[model samples]
Target: ANTAVKVSIDPAQDGPVINRHIFGQFAEHLGRGVYEGVWVGPDSTIPNTRGIRKDVVGALKALKVPNVRWPGGCFADEYHWRDGIGKPEDRRSRINASWAGRPEPNSFGTHEFFDFIQQIGADAFISANVGSGTVQEAADWLEYLTAQDSSLAKERAANGHPKPYEVAFWGIGNEVWGCGGPFTAEEYVTKLKQFSNFSTNHNKNMPTQQVAVGPDGDGFPEYAEVVMNAWSKRTWAWNIEALSLHRYTRNGWPPNIPATGFNQKQYASVIKETLGMNDFIKTNIAIMDKYDPEKKVGILVDEWGTWYAPTKGTDPGYLEQENSQRDAIIAALNFNIFARHADRVRGANIAQMINVLQAMILTDKEKMVLTPTYHAFRMYVPFQNAVRLKTNYDQGVYKEGDINLPKIDVISARDNQGRIWVAVTNIDPKQSIDVDLSLLGKSIASADGEILKAPTIDAVNSFAKPDVVSPKNLSLKAINGQLKFTIAPQSVSVISVKSQ
Candidate 1:
């Protein structure tokens, strides 16, 4: 058994409202995430809304996904908007070597993305190409997406929709540091300055936010400074709404490969790897504050979550990893991280949404099942519109072999409507943590919670039984003003406190 950690809450130092955008998801044209996952086209027998899967849309909708970043990771830079829009047959077919190395027929393009976003009720944040793409193409896309009653609007009408799809957020390029092209900070900034020149339509009063790939968050502050410096000339806020930061929970392919078939020890290692995202977001936000003092720009974790090896015999580019209880811990921890730092970190869209890396929903032909990570995202729905309250984690320690690592036990909440919520995770896989909970702001409270725990961290649900490792409701009445709670090692526990 591990010792209990105490968490204190203070309302004075409140952070930004956890943007529903922080809970946003990513959908790329790569792998099954787009083709088999989101788009099966209109000809399939499976029920779909004009080619996009209706079941998948309905599943993600229940999760309250606030925004969806589209087109690509590396594919964003290679994506030619011309190849995607207009009549289906009119769209071009190109060899996409970056993601899957297959010939991608632009069957599912910009209009399709907007249609899907509309169906899901999610804001669209499209990533523009800077590699193998141009300023004119980027400009034309912005016009096509945002223009209402002009030549661009006429083009949009000719394709299909007459109404404009207001894409509030935009990413200049993905990983301009690496796959976005190995350019120096100075080199990339020059490119960004040029891209910005074309992406803007000040004459039309078209409001759009452009995000730039930052300083290295493989973990460092230097690269962020280099990328944002080019925009110092903009006195009335950056043309970019969010500065993009792409960091995954783990580095290797099929991260669960080693832990997949192992026991508690390997499970502990895999779960611990998920906790490192806490450091990734915190350190990067600190860098952003130093450079842009007022924080007019937001830290957009556009691409995140675990990048692990594929399931055995699966296509590698598809990034089909086993989504287990450990993945749930990763979701809870990262969501809370975003909640804690909501002030500067406004938007976060996990890498690939479905049937790809760290996906929330997985499917096999028509046999679809939500992963544990999906439930965590759904459970976190309360924190979206909730006020960011000050949380004091009486830090605890989790031991892995000889290493004694400090662990954050709980995140507290005090919503705008006077409701208090605390979401806790015991990332330590070895033993349970008994916490002596207390409240600070207002006295006399009644509470309840739902906890998701399992025997091992790597446990997951297949099509056979989808109930494995899901959250179960718990009693959080805080017996006589004290809440005695035990968060199972390697699991997530959420508590809601209401004042009496």
Candidate 2:
């Protein structure tokens, strides 16, 4: 029997305006993620502007990417900003020990990344190196990018970017518990203060917002306890505005489960695990509340998405995988969870933007293709900067291999343009779910929808068939203030309503 989920939404009752920054992206200096994924030097056959691929720039622009975190995951912790500036030919090449031990040409340095960010009109969220780099190095890097009058300004002009860049978000460090520094919570808290103290705002135009490394969801790491507790003790001097959290649904390490070719049991396991982010956010928020009582610090899930084993013959450090409809469902579920907790959740960056774990776009040489995840993001774009509406739904279960998941996941919001949009995801790969939407006390004259779905759970858009899972127009009508629709199995649907 097809499960039925009921959603009741009240437009008058609104929550926080969903932060547009939550739709942020990450670009790490790993594998082709940097070199071929986004950059393909100016002289190359691939159409590029000053080395960055134009096609990728155009696509990311369409998504209206809010902010981009550059030069890392673990890569930022080990990177030295100086190596990426100056002449591309003169830039030094270093071994990327953090990712697949590949050689980083340093061709795509600070200038190139900022150029790409400018091309797409996205804000910059930089992750500074703290584990191995010195305080002066981190401080100088900030000065070089944001300072108005400094030797660094002349240095920037020497490097080709004459004007000072505006960088508002600064990540103090990344993954301090693991790849970052292996520091104890107490140890990291002290270092966090020390490093943040030096990260000054040179450009008064854009004041920087410092983000401290929080914890990995595994065991809900104790770093949060020590850092938050310490902040409570010394609130006056605390400079951190956010805490970063990273979580991935890899099922198991090393022998990670397959990305595309998988059975429902494997899919169910991944879905169940991805759903665990809700608890992770809640647990961390409780800790944040206890320490700050006022919610002064925001939570940024900076590194997230489904990380699977590399495609068969690929380099292990590349961290590449194929995205499928399952990934689309997972993305929708995660976004919905974030929207529900918009107050404390300020921003999130999908593990990567291209050619990496659960990426939105995939590029081969000059050819680029949008993945199912891309369409999922396109469908949910209206939720950005929109006022989250108060919603309640009667949940139904989607059972597979002893694991039962709530059949329907949803987020409702009213955009600044005076439009109401509802994003709904039916995660069941086998059965379609009928949704009965009641816009309480709010009248709607008509409704239109776009849905991304496929025939099977593992259905994907290959180079040969890029549009296999793109969003399609769906005909919908609101009858007597109620909208009834059937969301396809393993699908994400976005519906927009015009009021009476």
lDDT of each: 0.77, 0.88
lDDT string for model 2 (1-500, tens) is 77788898899998998998888899999888888999999899999998889889988888889999988889999999999999878999999989988888898999998999999999899999988988899999999998777899899988788789999699988987888897888989888888888888788888788999998876447878888887777645457889898888876567487887899988988999999999999989999999887889999999889998788888777888888999899999999888888899999999899998889889889899998988888788899999999888966777887998888888899999989999888888888887888788877688999999998888888889888888988778788878888888898999998778
What 10-residue stretch in candidate 2 is worst by lDDT?
230-239
RMSD of each: 2.5, 1.3
Candidate that would win on lDDT: 2
Tens digits of per-residue lDDT, candidate 1, 1-500, equal 46677776665566668777899899887777888898889999989989989899999888888888888888888888888887887788998878768789989898898889889888888889987688788888887777787898789888888877777777888887778776777787777877876785422343667888785446435567776565556645235556887777664533544425666555556556666666776777676677677888888888888777678888777677878887888888888777777888888998779988888888888878888889898888888777787777766676677656556556766677777778888777777787777667555367778988876677888889898878898755567666777777777887787654
TM-score of 2: 0.98
Q: What's each prediction's TM-score? A: 0.93, 0.98
User: Where does candidate 2 clash, by residue pair?
Assistant: 100-317
Model 2 misplaced stretches (Cα beyond 4 Å): 235-238
